[model samples]
Target: MTLDFFSPVSDLVLAHNELLSPQALGKKIKIHSEKKGFPELGDVSIVVFGVLENRNDVNYIGEVFQLNEIRKIFYSLFPGSWNTVIADLGDIKAGETVEDTYFALKTTVCELVKQNIIPVIIGGSQDLTYAMYRAYDTLQSMVNLVSVDAKFDLGDSSKPMKNNSFVGKIILDEPYNLFNYATVGYQTYFNSQEEKDLMDNLYFESYRLGEISNNVTLVEPVMRDANVVSVDLNVVQGSEVSLKQKFSPNGLNGKEICAVARYAGISNKVSSFGVFEYKPSKDDEMTSMLVSQILWYFIEGVNCRINDEDFSDDRSYQKFITLVEDQELVFYKSNMTGRWWIEIPFLSNVNNKLKRHTLLPCMHQDYIDACENKVPERWYKAFQKNSI
Candidate 1:
């Protein structure tokens, strides 16, 4: 069956207006609709799908998800320097039960990933990230998840699932495939001390909003290491996304959030990406345009992807070795992009799933810090995770 999950986009919104202009993105991209029908995605690189399920969103109960408003702005924008074929897969309607919706989403994502197609998810709630994570269950590898959010959302796993608490469910659920989880632009006041402590105890990473706002590039390495990246619009300040689920006065501004999205798209390992917690309002032009630009940057990044996985080609990279506190550290700098990576030595005779990830994305500052006898925290955490 064709999943029987997705509904046609042409049926969901008003008749195509500016979306059908010759130079508009809507005219250039394939749409899953009643007239033109579902996309024949053999050459498609990115598929955008909107989820209409939001029963699990604690902040906005029974609020209708208006993804079409987002689409109006997104599809009307002019294309960038992208050559990757893109498709708008339309919306996945809410099922009778939230679990049913999750199943449909998981099935859809799993299939897309299997076909090597990157899914750009516009979600009804951030809890949809749980379903996105479950889509990787069959891959048989440790999953690295990076979320752009203001709060930790580490609610009690014992209770019912909601957007605010889905991360706890992901952590406590079975199968045990999650390897690393990182939160970018997190505000300290929004998260409980216990949740903050939990992140530390697990050796997971967390970057404060102020820290990232001061240095946006700090998220690049984290995004590069991620296999799945989810953005909660609530991470953006109220001024940027005024209609977001939970508006905050202090958070990442428009440009910063878009940069984070672009980083996720540029990551060769990231196969699935989502933007959630958006609630459309009448005066939603700015929010919709912002979301559209974020999507644009992601596509732009995908178009400019660099293949730097292999280091055997001496002409492509420079290798550096430094001694810190009697420990030998090895790093590689990509001549093509100037990106740095540090080698995490695998233990002999160890049967670790992460043994294949010997080299991890890092910043040049980490190398400088290692030279100053300060071991980077990112390296230490990866080393510990690999030891486990």
Candidate 2:
């Protein structure tokens, strides 16, 4: 059988070393390396993305990527690998069996993540998320999902081969609770009212374009607990953009895209990330540059999350307004063996919409114990500092 998946693709980068790039958000570069492959869990990762097939725009006539630049990005992290492990998940033809592709992606992601290395998946289809979720949860046990896309990916489950529905498969199957689910930039036309109702019942936090545009501060709390983040490039609208099913018109821009990516990386809970739907089929140099910028933002955000211990903000009139609006942050506490969360909304220095809003470890047993029994310990007094 002639396979349409493994089309030859090009890659690039030069001698490995820790060097900064021109548009990088993070000033520093570091990598955790294997003896002859990608870095493991604790090590910082430097993955250079390339299309699985050569479709000119998709892989650029087998000249999909620059090897020298890839090497430069990797080496800039200063990791020493005898040989690099480059994973290409195949072209993913339109009619290809989903099961076959899913398994391949699942196994590959598990392998990379098992080594504790951050596996950054860059490719075309959103179906990649299904395999990613299965892999991370199966191998790592517990994980929370975050999606940054223009649609909820909740199409009909009856049609197995459709563009959307992987997410539907996951949620309807209850493979994981939809409680941790959060999405941004949803289009009304792209999603149905029935689907929205289902998501509400499932407890997924989502914001349409209008809501987020009116107030972006809503994203931080929704993502504070997320572990795996996925982004769809279609959320951006521009002439240079590309995709198999393009619909970026009247959407966010490249800088806003980087802002979200940066937020994901800065999330202390997020461990793995995927950027999908970046089909170079209609892409221009500007699109490539935008993608590159998003990557840099990811690195920079991670750096900021890991290093910045203090979570303070500038106190100003604008900040006060933001704080006032955010004071309605939600709070959730589990009383019955952690099976269910009791959600309550209240105002605070943090953003409201309550239910474990702050990721600052503020929902610990000690806090619960102190508040539940009205028994205040001097030690508990100091625990508030850590928000535990």
Candidate 3:
């Protein structure tokens, strides 16, 4: 089993756990340790693990890092009134080569996902998202990725993969499982003109940082449709994190980032989630605490999940149809959660990535816009991609 790829949590972290309150997360969840080996997974709903590979950070200068501090902080926090079973699977150390590390992560994530357990990965660099995305190769035919970052990270695909350019590799690489990619909280100055043009030319979605900061709930519908959600810690404002982790002065605050994590957790379709680009430093208490709270909110969101996506039952949802510029748009609203979804009509003549009719998550405003004879940009992009 891929569990063999993991090393047990350090003795220091476990010893620290002994001092936490009984209601703390460390005292409640199953954990891997030197004494107990691997934990039982039969009843686990969420699994947390760390990958210690960051050689591809672009600015790497042979510095080593660990997740012990983050683990200690996370374990000390009190969990909400949650019913989900969580496990700390410990860390996957950097292998002899980066490729070996990727293989281990991909295999481990594949194992957990096949068992219907969500994997919340804490990573060495944002490029590890490529490994997380690769884990879905055999499990899913088409994958939707949502990245919360300050930059689009679409570096030149011709060169080797770095944390800043891994998205380029994901798009150009083989197997072609990626169906849709969205960037949330992207800072305009961080991305180049070509990268911005590429995002538009490909029909991918990107939300500006100002836009997301103004309305954090805009992430909910985007997360609702994602299969993999990768968050770059650098997306958070520099003031909110450790000195070493400060990537931008202007970015999401702690509260906004936690809300984004909760949205990812609440998504019924999101199977794997990751927080990346964490750099260990001497004064990392604030960063650790923030990361811990992000995990807490995600688990809380998972506990609050409602199965309101099933449209087979007419009583579960309300349907509305509107005409916009000679085209008829159909919308469905969940009676349980009051969430909205717009249908993407199937094109029989075209070879479509989505073989059947699929519901694209949208806001209530999208429906209102359709009633005014205006097409939602999201619906238009999905339709355009389907036709291509």
What lDDT score belongs to each candidate, Candidate 1 first? 0.88, 0.52, 0.93
Candidate 3 segments exceeding 4 Å error? none
Q: Write the per-residue lDDT of candidate 3 for residues 1-388, one digit (tens) a residue.
A: 4766899999999999999999999999999999999999999999999999999999999999999999999999998999989999999989999999999999988888999999999998889999999999999899999999988999998999999999999999999988899999999988899999999999999999999999999999999999999999989999999988887889999999999999999988889999998998999999999999999998888898999988999999999999999999999999999999999998989997886338999999999999999999999999999999
TM-score for each of the candidates = 0.96, 0.62, 0.99
* Clash count of each predicted structure: 0, 33, 0
Q: What would the per-residue lDDT of candidate 2 be over residues 33-129, giving only the tens digit for each residue?
A: 2222332323334333332321212223333332233324333332222122323222333224446666665665676566655556665566677
- Find the candidate with the highest TM-score and give its number: 3
Question: Which has the better TM-score: candidate 1, or candidate 3?
Answer: 3
Lowest lDDT 10-residue stretch of candidate 1: 10-19
* Superposed Cα deviation of residue 142, candidate 3 (Å): 0.1
Model 3: lDDT equals 0.93
Candidate 1 to truth, TM:
0.96
| lDDT string, candidate 1, 127-171, tens digits | 999999999999747899999999988998899999999999999
Note the residue pairs that clash in candidate 1: none
- Model 2 error, position 33 (Å): 15
Over 4 Å off, model 1: 1-3, 11-14, 17-20, 243-246, 349-351
Of the pair 1 and 3, which is ahead by lDDT?
3
